[model samples]
Target: MNITRRALLAGTAALPLVASAQTASGVGRRTMNHVKDHITRLVDQHRDGVAPIVSLGDPVLRQPADPFDGQVDDKLLAEFIELMQRTMRAAPGVGLAAPQIGVPVRIAVLEDPATVSDEVAEARHRYPLEFFAAINPDYRPNGHKRRGFYEGCLSMPGYTGVVNRPYSVHATYTDPTGHPHHKTFTGWQARIVQHETDHLRGTVYVDKLEPRSLSTTENYLDNWNDPIPTRAAQALRFHLD
Candidate 1:
């Protein structure tokens, strides 16, 4: 799922200001530096035109997004969606939300082509999702069955945490062209949808994680990628139903 970050208006000037706010919000110096470098890279990559993805601790991410009003052929909305797609691809993430790029609009994009090994795919019950965008999305758990899996976000670069979510979800939303859509997603696709939907409602994966299970990407790859530790669920007090 694409994680949303930052609260400032878009542009170079807004970055430093957001960085300072992140610092004041008690994010460590190391984390702040990491975020700055991250923001710089995003800006450099999208220098052509894409908007930058915000980093965590920006108050904007905590605010609920505005609903898309179905403005078909809206030039600015079209540009925003294009830039978000480009940004998600550059981040190499499976999904992204407008809140991730400093716009608090209820719009998101997600896609996955079963890019991992069969082992990993089976572990997560993964499947392919053709590219799609949702506006003003609303969703709910489809069943009591839940699955826990490692989750990451483009906005929260270099971290992965385990979050348990329902194995299936039902959702309804409008497409950019004002067409409405409703579907039930299972497995990894459900996870992706829930993650993006969380952003629209002003939440992130961290909020649902067993906090101690959260780790940097490097550390997770080095130490935790194998069989999940037995006490992880107990420690996080998470119940896998």
Candidate 2:
């Protein structure tokens, strides 16, 4: 989303500014440098418009990450930046994490695909995406209220599921640089966060869906554009006794 110049300036000015020296541990330094190089490559790739993809078999994609230790330098930070950009770009997605790419690091990036502001005419740019980073994240529903909708996953590929999610959420996490951040989200943003966090826990979207909600990929695509069926229909189904 085009944050008006005023909004962008205000947001930047509000950020906490803290710079720390990079620490030296032989193995850690090597790892950090490697990650940094990856980030550089990914950024260049993004500029060239080639999307990156992280598959389901990667080690990083399978494990949950530990909390950040705050010793990352430019190099380590760069690796994470590249992973985030590549995964999101390749999936034509708005969010992804290190665990999704075979790295066990506690990191993820997300952006809302619909970020247009009122001042910008929707007809001119109806869908504006904004990127966000989350390291060692924790997310949960803010209340008992929920909404049911269809969700898709990059690792799961052609699969989609109908699942219930909270209408809003409050999440906390560190940034690639080990800085703490918090935010609240609603609608699709909340759904994406909840979905990705499940991946961090080694769960897929299918695990969270009811049997009736499961659909073959072809059927899913066909019905994906249809409005959600009414709640009454969901409640009225009968099965063989």
**Evaluated with lDDT, which candidate comes out highest?**
1
What stretches of model 1 exceed 4 Å from their correct place?
Answer: 2-49, 70-73, 227-241
lDDT of 1 at 74: 59
Clashing residue pairs in candidate 2 are: 35-79, 36-75, 39-78, 60-99, 60-102, 60-103, 61-99, 61-102
Model 2, 1-241: lDDT tens digits are 1112222222200122122323333555555555545555555555545434555566555555433444356674665566567556555566676556554455667775554455332322224337767766778788877766555666556555567777788988776665777888776667677776666666656677655765545555455323453442355341211
C-alpha lDDT score of every prediction, in listed order:
0.69, 0.55
| Local accuracy of candidate 1 as per-residue lDDT tens digits, 95-200 | 8887788766688988776666687777778878898888888888897998886677767776777887899999888887778898999988898999998998
TM-score of 2: 0.66
Q: Score candidate 1 by TM-score against the native.
A: 0.76
| Candidate 2 regions with alpha-carbon error over 4 angstroms | 1-54, 57-60, 70-72, 115-129, 231-241
